[model samples]
Target chain A: MRFINVIKVALRALRRSAMRSILTALGIIIGVAAVIAMVSIGNGAKSQVEASIASLGQNIISVYPGSATTGGMHGGWGSASSLTVDEALTIRREISGIVAVSPEMRDRQQVLANGLNWNSSVNGEDVTYLDIRLWTIAEGEMFTEGDVNSAAKVCVIGQTVVAKLFPDGDPVGRSLRIRNLPFKIVGVLKAKGFNYFGSDQDDVVIIPYTSHLKRIARRPNLNSIIIQAESPDQMTRIQQDVTDFLQQRRNGRDPDFTVRNQQELAEAATATTKTMTVLLGAIAGVSLIVGGIGIMNIMLVSVTERTREIGIRLAVGAHGRDVLTQFLVEAIILSVMGGTLGILLGVGSSQLISRLNGWPVLVSTSAIVGAVAFSAAIGVFFGFYPARKAAQLDPIEALRYE
Target chain B: MSHVVQLEDIHKTYESGEVPVLAVRGVTLTITGGEFVAIMGASGSGKSTLMNLLGCLDRPTRGRYLLGGTDVSNLDRNELADLRNQKLGFIFQGFNLLSRTTALENVELPMLYGRRHFSTREIRERARQSLDIVGLSNRADHFPSQLSGGQQQRVAIARALINEPQILLADEPTGNLDSKTSVEIMGVFQKLNAQGITIVMVTHELDIAHYCKRNLIMRDGRLVSDTPVVDRLVATEQMQRIVTAETDAKLIA
Candidate 1:
């Protein structure tokens, strides 16, 4: 028989049992839809995490002092005063890949400005702090290195502080009192949203470490140092250089500081999300296999039910190959049609979910194409046996079937 | 006259579980072109098996069977199918018209599998002509379920004739119909035979066998008798007599 005529006959046969065909296709529909939806949701979450990690800082490394131990009572990391402002400057000058470095000291302090009082974290850092943290001054210029050298009482306030203390007016060029000492606001930092730990990132004030030691906290050995590499590719090299330099400075006495890079943190976080994505994709894949089995089951039933029709076709001169092609084509048409509908449903539902839950979801084009192709493969894989059964039937016996 | 079918000592055996049953044992026959012949037998006398062999629906287990000069007894399944498509048409006891299909589409079915490529337009035109030959052109759009038994049989005949086969093989074509409808269906066969189409039909009814020009009787898996009908019954005349008798009985009642 001509290929088109065989296809026509298959379609006509399927149309004769439209409701049954649809019911048979439903399994594939749900399977493909689940695969698409699950994969999209997983990819969305992974990318969201990556974006958040990117926002933290690029190629950043933090060096914190080892824990303080007094009389065998040990405090946690960054409790000892091992790192100093001199070491921070020396590393910045000596390291090849180092772009900037800052010594950091943090304390919670009450601030008074414009007849309002707010309690916010006060951070003492050098001029390189902004560069290492990838923070920008949105309102006014940053305090210069000269200001740090002079122990100038100048500060950069974050957006959360601005919203709290300077709600009615701009804080730049204005003085705010921290711990009863007045400090002039040099810049207002741009708003940085919440971190992965759900803490407000824009709830702090930054002042020169020298100024902080002289005017606010009084005595402070450097708590930690933040370093920035020239590029992300140079992070590990710079980290190793810093570690060796710090070890030499400490006389290699069991390492008094810990050097941690932002890449490590990002990799750890992304690993978890990647595992989750694969898990979801695998679960969805199981459903697809189940759907393939369902197709096989229905196709077997269809072959049995159409025995007489197959006999009639054979009697009218249809070859066994023609009958086989007809049934196989029917199965393929069902799966492909189901796959198309599933893709539409998946995309539509993903969009609906994004709208309702405010979650990011990415419907990849490759995924859609892969799903359609896979379903077609499933049709072929599952449709073969039943079609062969129909083809091998004895026409005389089939015609005589009641 | 060239013979359309020549069976040389054909034998068919059935392997039923542990027992082998001989269905047709050494049946030899020859049917020429344009001859209307009927094979008659009891239920287990192997007449149906002979029809199956003649239709190329089954390969003879032993002996030579030639259809239109092609030795078909040893042909493979696909070749036999091609022979059936190109050389023979089949009409079943139950008018095997596809139920949901229109009569026109049912008639177009055989052409769909024809060896010659037929365009859709040509297929439709030829199907209409075949239906016209069966006097079913007006009922072309009706489905088999919607048609009467005789109309369905006529549609099946149209389907059979669409391929322009050399021979028509009908197995109990009127077994499901009333006697009046049987005569009406036989009239269609006679008309096709008069147009030079060879026909081989199977029936148990002796009266039905008398409608053909020749009768072959089978018994115990063998051909017991093969004879030309001395006084063949004309299907149209018999149909007219049946109608008249029915009308007179209705008038008397």
Candidate 2:
């Protein structure tokens, strides 16, 4: 019954000063909305990273040449003297825990189909490269292992390159020119969209690894070695095995080689996303603290304005605790109302982002509950001083107050 | 046999900077059940302070204050609040009706804070009864600001009477009214007092004090005189004649 009267008084006072109450609530609204929006964007970025890492295939490992820069013509070396084709063959034959191996060679070159010509990365790797990297042909067929062995002049074109170079035909089995060397298009690769840096992935051509090493650049060393483990659990052991194998092959000769596992790459990306999420959330939380301060200021003013009213109630039989409860209820109502509105706006904004930019967004139940609870806590914490001040007022002085 | 209020050697001193300003000093008084008493003093004569002490709104700095056999001056804050809720009702000089509340709700305020529960209909009915006692039943829905000073004072009187307190304490209850409104408010008080309700009014007007059966005049926070009015100024019959005469004048106009 006492609580009901407190709410009644709060509602009455709020109605009396509608504009001030709404303005006070606006602070809470902004605070809650900021928290939710920041968290959602954080979650969205995280999921985007996870999707990118997932596309890279969890079973694969990547190896790149050391320094591709030693004594260059301009920007260092054209390619390193490390990672020969012999090493790739040796890893394939000797590494016990390794399930598959694919050596990759890539260079930026101009490729032409009919009259259309564009500069794009032309990657040279075998059939196992596609299997280990989880790349699938969306049309026609892949180059055979025989084609790889023979350094066949056949290629798989990416979606963007296909669209740009062959707008009017299938281009499959059609011959394309890679800087004066002709290669038939064996397949059209599926669209991989963007990488972590928002760079286009569907702009490369894939050809036999030996074709680029022998016929294209005529280089003896490898740029990168890609491998796949039998299972995700064997990734660490397989990484060690491959490292040891390379070291032994080089006669413990400071091989200057590094092996990156899929798990480590995923962990690094997740940690980065988590850090970004916390930083954004902390920035938003500062606004909530400011909003709480606003509540405290307004509550103190309200207590002063209602001092005589408090006295009247006290003289008419309201306890000091009743006065405290009434003002506290008002503060709570303001914060909870603001929190509810902010959650709605935040969720709506996240959905808008997802729709506009095709970014992944998720609004978790915990964030909603957490925002509401945090707003309520702000109300109680900030409302206490004012409520206590009002409650401790001398009734005689308060009654005499103008 | 029982007194509604009793004060023995009450003294209240307020500090103004370093010196203590005596607001009420060495005062003793008593109001038995069913008595109408008026406290009279000049401005700053400590009449308001005396009323506050009588209404249980403030404690005397040093004194024994008993309300209906209970020593109220020694009571704690909560106890005083409970005592005020149960035993005392107040009508102030400014009426002091809660501005936003309707006349009926204002009358019901004391009951709302009481320990008992009343249904909405019951509360409304009781408030209506109190308003009817003050002849403002038709204006139960009117807000304090909407009413005339006399009507507002009557509404305040209704609020004071709703709790059926052991004593009705009125502090300068007619100070804000014109002569005619003052007479009307005093008539209402007289009617309530005739129903055997104890009334203690603090006022400065001689005419207002003359309406009470007993009068106490204060000087420098001390009661200088306590005497019964040999012939009450309004005297019931003369006030009725004047009211009828005014109605006739209004009709003539």
Docking quality tier of model 2 = medium
- List the candidate 1 regions with Cα displacement exceeding 4 Å: A58-60, A70-75, A93-100, A126-134, A144-152, A179-182, A218-220, A228-244, A252-255, A260-279, A365-370, A398-402, B248-253
Clashes of each: 0, 1
Residue B22 of candidate 2: its Cα lDDT? 98
lDDT by residue for model 1 (B7-84), tens: 999999998668888999999999999899999999999999999889989878899998888788888888888888
Worst 10 residues of 2 chain A by lDDT: A69-78
True contacts kept of 1: 0.69
The CAPRI classification for model 1 reads as medium
lDDT of 2 at A239: 80
